[model samples]
Target: MLDLTKLAREMQGISQHLSQEAVASRQRLELAQQHLKKAYECQQEVMERQEKWRDRILFANATPLEPLNTRIDIPVPPKVHTVIATDGSQIAPNHHEIAYCYLLNIGRVVLHYGQNRYPLMDSLPEVFYRPEDLYMSRQWGIKTEEWMSYRRTASEATVLAELVREVGTGDGGLGTGRRKTGDLGSREENNNQSLIPHPQSPIPALAMVDGSLIYWFLEQLPVDARDRILPPILEAWSQMRAAQIPLMGYLSASRNVEGVNFLRLLACPHPAPDCVSYCPNQLEKVPCKVFEPLRDTALWTTQLTPGQRGPLWRSNNRILELYADQTIYFCHVHVGTEIARIEVPAWVAENTAMFDQALGLMLAQVQKGCGYPVAIAEAHNQAVVRGGDRTRFFCVVRETND
Candidate 1:
């Protein structure tokens, strides 16, 4: 074993240095606290005054904002419901290895909640050896890891869509509602009112993904390559929407500050007829500049209670812009004192019943796993490639090839 004396001394010195830096940082924050408070006040004031001219901000297409102070307590899920989640892991290509290739694995878990929680697990691992997979294409100019990541996300979506379709259209799925001794329209009205299923009614199911529906990295590719890569994702999304399966992207310990950016937009002190072009330098000014460093989770931490979720805020990114009509919305949620960021598409957000049901199931999943979603946790567990497994995998491949 190595001697600890020298290592201990070095660690002590580093710890002391970190402590001094922390003290200095706290002092700096204290100095800026007043400016941040003033910036927040300005943001609230501007939002109040621009109620009628709200479209001005939307037209600018910078950061979008909903009401920031609203919070809703998600309801508990039904006794008998199903949640399906998918996650992916990758082993990137290593130049030192004999083969110039990459590996991707998608793991899926379906949990049925009833008298007892039953889980179904599945995984698909793919190896890429094509010329396009091993080298950067002249057309796209993207590395293998980047393109493979998008492909994996598309694969996850495809799997989720297929699962949802199977459940929704299968026997005793959502399509088969309980027809009581009444007219068809009356039965439809009754089915709409009830959150739980009737004896013969189709069971409700939700399909979840570990990340956002819109793959933002697709922006890195050229138009032609982007078109080629986008059809699978779009088709999967379309299928999910048509199937009425609420798809959620859950991010634990998310550090996104999109909400803070929106507040900064509102706090801009410039008096321009058009905020985007004319007020370019407004953010560098006093109040807006103060909030530039704060994120939504940090700013709203004190406002949210356990199990509470905030109002939806629209995304202003280019990918969301590409699908402006079918935009994505997100909100912060407090799960057992740990905050998480959740994203859903416009189709789920617009339907109140569906949104409530989806959020309820998510909350239940988190409760079951303390602070994280159980379905996602199991999927990750199945997808992860441990160090020993990775070594053995390469060794086996080499042996087979030799």
Candidate 2:
């Protein structure tokens, strides 16, 4: 009853199927290997090209660029002296989420204050970037669309106009451009359109906007808006004489050693000896040495009190609490021979009371035996304090001016 020929045919059919599957698998494996090889080759080539570019940029001993002479030299006008310090904060719906940006512009005036901080002028012309305009599409990865209505509101413009009117007004009355005319004899007559100059006030209307948003808005503004807004600011600066009040700007940096090393590598051609053979596993054994005399130079060092000594020595927790106001304190050790220009923050400059109580105490120690005109720079320069809370304070001191 056993059919040997049929059984032989079935076994041969199974062997053929297995052979076909094995060939298919071999083809797939070869394709994967080829793709991996191509990727590795591309990555290696890119790395080599980047290294060459880096060497060319870093190694070249380029001379410092001369200051540009394109700055506009407007004549200084005679007017009343006033210091208008304007700070703008871009606040979102929720305080928990990160803000787009915050900017502070402080304009100082040496005018006599009769009643209050500078006599109560009718109004002050304050220019600020609208919060609604600060809805940055780049943050949310959205593109600005042409079809969308991209114009500022009438109310917003009115608010700015009112501010200007108040600031420009004096004992005589509100400055020109305060009223709307009616149609007379079926024709609208241009009557009170005149540039009435403020006699007592020569202090240019100081307007500090939040970040670079003002520049963007300027590009989109109508010719009329641009004319109205810019004049006051330019006049204010002209009156103040750009040299008098120190105009401050902010730049940020990384706190970690790796970040500092990368910056040094970018700035100069000299490769760090320890960084040449960097290994994550050998980090513990290798004693980390600060390279680049200019950047690596520690400006100030505060000795940890007996109570805070243990935590102060730890790597990340090196910062010690100095004052009761909760300002974080850390000892900075300056080792370089050359004097470094340090950048300070706005809060330290504006809030003399807090600076005296908290920062002044710490800086007092460093100022001892040091020459006068010693600059005490703040560490995180770009950070802007929006709210009244003094708890959220962070500071860092950089060795270089840039």
Candidate 3:
């Protein structure tokens, strides 16, 4: 009986050891699988990099040839004007918070009511465009903030519709329509009819948003939303034409998927000259005339030596520093005979590359004089709020005299 007991104890010990060994083997297999996954991921990254290089080469070789320019000078009409409006907003990540700032330009017409002054035509024609309506939240994170902020602040389609309705019916306190009477009418009736005048020629107004948010908003819109917005845009176009308005444009500026800033120029077909073009470089020369005087007096005063300023001026390094430091700098640039000194934040300098690309693209397009109305918008990360958390997308409209 003692020997049998000894044998049973030995078998039990051996079984326990084998169980532990099996668990260890399973762990080893799992570790091997993880290593293989890492290797596969690395290989994928390499393949992607090689494919991108090949694509770049193909694109570089396929540059499109420029079109021939036909020289023509047409007489411009008197009282022909263009209206431009710009607005910006911020979107935060995973929240419902948003902020907005907007500016409207009604060509030469300026109207004042109480303490507020508005352009003759408001960009957000509907009451929905009120600044107080702007808010911030973070439910959707960064992506949601961007989309919602843009949806509310960057779309001019609603505003344009309101303008058309106002002009067409003369209903928004403008008192436009007049009554007419036949000769058979009595003297009092004739007098009343004479007091009414013909409808004035509608002023061409171009509502401009700062980015491609307008397009994006339109694209993501549901079928019902599209049905609601499209009619108003078209109606506005028709009213302007009926009133003999030459042309109207909507400009959007945005960044490409690569984060490069660009302007989306669009317009209704009209007799006005319009075109789209781009410059390879626009911010090459610093607006030194605007900055030199201020730099000497305020930025690089006697406290800072010329040697220090020298490094700052080298290839926008100083500008970048100022922006990173968030300091205010004065720029001096020549506008006509007088030197214009402009105060700008250092952040503008840090973002010079993006601004340059956007400005260059717009200037090139405006220079073309193609006779079609155009709108331009810009998209990129801009430091809008005081704190770093307020960073958001901005859009602007570009207006050209030509």
The best candidate by TM-score is 1
- Model 1 agreement with the true structure over 305-352: per-residue lDDT tens digits: 987887776776666666655788778888775778888888888888
Please, what is the TM-score per model? Answer: 0.76, 0.24, 0.28
Candidate 3, residues 123-207: lDDT per residue as tens digits? 2111122322323213223243343444433233333333334434433212212212111111111111111232465433333
How should the candidates be ordered by TM-score, best one leading?
1, 3, 2
CA lDDT of every candidate: 0.66, 0.27, 0.28
Q: How does residue 86 of candidate 1 score in lDDT?
A: 77
What is the alpha-carbon lDDT of model 3 when measured against the actual structure? 0.28
Error of 3 at 153 (Å): 6.0
Supply candidate 2's per-residue lDDT for 46: 30
Q: What is the lDDT of residue 35 in candidate 2?
A: 35
Q: Is candidate 1 or candidate 2 better by TM-score?
A: 1
Q: After superposition, how far is residue 275 of candidate 1 from its true place, in Å?
A: 7.4
* Top-scoring candidate (lDDT): 1
